[model samples]
Target: MAQAARLDIMSIAALVAFALTLGARTTFCEGISCGPGWEAFSSSCYKKMVDPNGWLGARFHCVLEGGDLVSFNSSAEEDFVKGKMGARSFWIGLSNLECNHKLCPQVSGKELKWSDNTLLNHSNWATVKVASTNLESCAYVLPNAHKDYHPGKWRKVSCESSLAYMCKRSPDGCQEGQPCNKTAGLALTPVQTSACDPGDFLRGHFCYRFENTKKTWQGAEDDCVLWGGHLASVHSREDGDWLIAHMEDNFHVGLKKNIKMFEWRDKTAMDPALWYPGYPSSDDCGRVSRTGQVYNHQCNSLIVFTCQKGVDVTHRHHQAHLVCAHLRSFSHPCSPAHSTSAAPRLE
Candidate 1:
């Protein structure tokens, strides 16, 4: 999420390449503090992003900043966010994109989820009752001060609507009992100040690092494995767009033609329909271009690649809650599975 702090990102399609160099920055930290422009509120730090973007794109920017789209877990939190928003509607981390009425609990018949993958325990919706359908939808908060809109109320909209967004992160900076120097202002990391590694970008609870160092597909995957992660895996259009936004040229991604289908090393299920145009399905490796197109590639070809790592317990627990909640909807008594099997690391 390093890129989010520096750019307004009103339109990622207009992004320009910029130079960024980092020294030896590693993952794992000890403490944190709210940086400039971030307000300390309750248990987290809040930052209002002044940019227009679709819900997914907005959330992507927040993840770049080492956070996710803001989640108002209570009425007070909702009011706090309303007070922070100026006149613009801001995208929140709430959605019902995966809601299947039969498999999940319904809020107005729509199951909402936060970007952090948590279920909605509280709501601040207006008259807009999102229609239950298979189509994706998101929620955004309207400023009450505006006479034309409902005050402190969330409105359902297509996830494609561009709007300003809010971000929240756990404060991290020099602190007592940690190997840190209070004198060193801002954040003490190898790269920038974020929840993930200083340099890695956070997306959907996963941390990704883009490496420009060209290496063969296998060599790239090996290096990522050496670093305790795996090659990057693209999950959706947003993921593909995110890669295009940060990268300037063609790069290798973590997928290979295994028999008749492409497989993600991390075990993420592939959506066959997501592959566009066509990937002759012949080459052994996968490559992505700045335009978000995938191609069949020779495994030994040298190219830059990305690496990905797992998230913390909070994120994992959120996933478990989602699955458990679904199972419970079927009347099956079950407990939340707090952990998951380790899969191949992805960049």
Candidate 2:
């Protein structure tokens, strides 16, 4: 019997030692804290900002800081943020631009995509609706015990509404152009445009040149493709106006038919077909000419053409310029134009 008790005591001692080792490796402290502008989130930290600016302006601010607006990824994340925010209202990075500004319930199944084309595939939303003004086409979250709506509820409001907000950064790596400055308190600086010259016919998200160089529809398409872009397809009247503003002469876009009279080359047909009123007639297949303030064109006739591709600043300076011109110009600064303190923010 004495031997049995001794064996049991030995087993208890081994268990105690194992637990102590584990506790050392995974220590949890009560009331742990992070630096200013940062709130504790599980094992990481987040920054919350309250911008009184409208939705568009708020979005600009977040991008200026090299981050998209807030997109919650989980219920626990939302609840944790709410607890940190206390009773204040804050903006989240979501909008119903595609849905005509209506409030959407907690998005399920496929994740939502932001206007800049970023995916909000993670969790970070409430299941209830909060008070919002009709002018409020944007959404925000409130943190409090008021579970008046279920947890993770989102309130749609006007973009013009002023509210507090939260910002998140991956504790693992800082975004490019944003440095972790211990002295500056984690605030992001604006990204700088490089000194490289703009490529062949591209400037600021629009592709163009000052002189009209003659080429066939096929030739123009080939030139654009050589530059790693295809012929342009104007999406809106605004696009037409933009093209007109830069051109010293008329140009052609892809929209031609083969000798067989079948429509080819104009790749934009794959997208929702958009044309000026009374456009795309049998005779107008490849025609584009500028008349005073308007543009007219035929697909088969040769005129200078514009092509476009997306831009990435991280690319080599020359390559970036070539790519930007081939795709489209980076016309808008990464930051919006209205704020002097704000810098350009790209996706």
Candidate 3:
């Protein structure tokens, strides 16, 4: 009778433990749930920025909000975006300028790819023929006849043009103790100020380091890549000013001039404003002037160059967590049950 009573107590204890565990899990899920303004779909959350801006501006805006421009991985994703899009067009995170042949002017090749480097298996390009040119290389959504309500279709547009943009993020971004940005609809780790790794200087979420050790234009690019980054690409005047103010000497930027043409290492057009007056039309590499203006220098000229490493490592890590969580939620691995002997052997 005492043994049976003890057994009953153990069972009750087990039930209580299970209840506590289930409640804890439920609380955790609620804690990490997407906050206001962000629409939840699957394991991810998304938000659309209403203000129109240039492609780079839109991209930067999304980054500041702790996400990137939206990129669809499947038809369901595309459909979700369409539903959010309504009748208005917006920018999606799709472009080839970063990996296109325009970067290597000397190398003969024709390749257009996405900025995120997603493998190409699906696309919803517009049927209408739009002239393909370097000027309008960035991708955007256009109207299509697939469905009257879902008018979003894909096409290239000039990156300089202003347009509304969308962002996609995952809920796993909410690290422990981090408060959610309910207004932006992101449950993300607090956006920290740019911090550089040892031997690098923080510059607006990018870590920059000037290597006085001279190398050719291509050699500099290779070195930067080996160091896990690329040659610096100056975007805003503020960026250029910062580089000029911080550098003791003129340094090569990612820009390379071959023949009479100039392009960034990523094959994107270097903003003409970055060039010093009467610059270019020369066969050489690009260098930052003391005044922050850009000028062409001989490609073989051994000169100091700056490298820029991104501070988005956390974003990538959180994305990996989201992928893992999705897989685990949907998959059930086989669990071997413990075998019971027909009867305990008399010992």
Best by TM-score: 1
RMSD of 2: 21.0
Query: What TM-score fits each model?
Result: 0.39, 0.33, 0.36
Better of 2 and 3 by lDDT: 3
**Residue clash pairs of candidate 3:** 103-267
Q: Which lDDT value does model 3 have at 36?
A: 62
Q: Rank the candidates by lDDT, best first.
A: 1, 3, 2
Ten contiguous residues minimizing lDDT sum, candidate 3? 100-109
Q: Model 2, residue 237: what's the lDDT?
A: 49
Error of 3 at 304 (Å): 56
Candidate 3 structure quality by residue, lDDT tens digits, 1-347:
11211221222222222223333333232344555677888877788777665454455444434455677778898888877877555677765344321121111112345544466667776544434333224567743222322246675543433456787666765323222233333322211111233334434345666677888888888889998889998775666755655455677889876455777776788788777888775566888876667888887888878888765434323333442333234342222222221111100
Which digits, one per residue and each the tens of the lDDT, describe model 2 over residues 80-139?
A: 777766666566777653321111222222323443333565544444332322221456
What global local distance difference test value does model 1 have? 0.56
Query: In model 3, which regions exceed 4 Å deviation?
Result: 1-32, 99-111, 128-136, 144-151, 174-347
- The lDDT values for all models are 0.56, 0.42, 0.53
**Candidate 1 residues 49-120, lDDT tens each?**
775655545654554455667887788877787788875567888776432211112222245677565567
Q: Residue 88 error for model 3, in Å?
A: 0.9
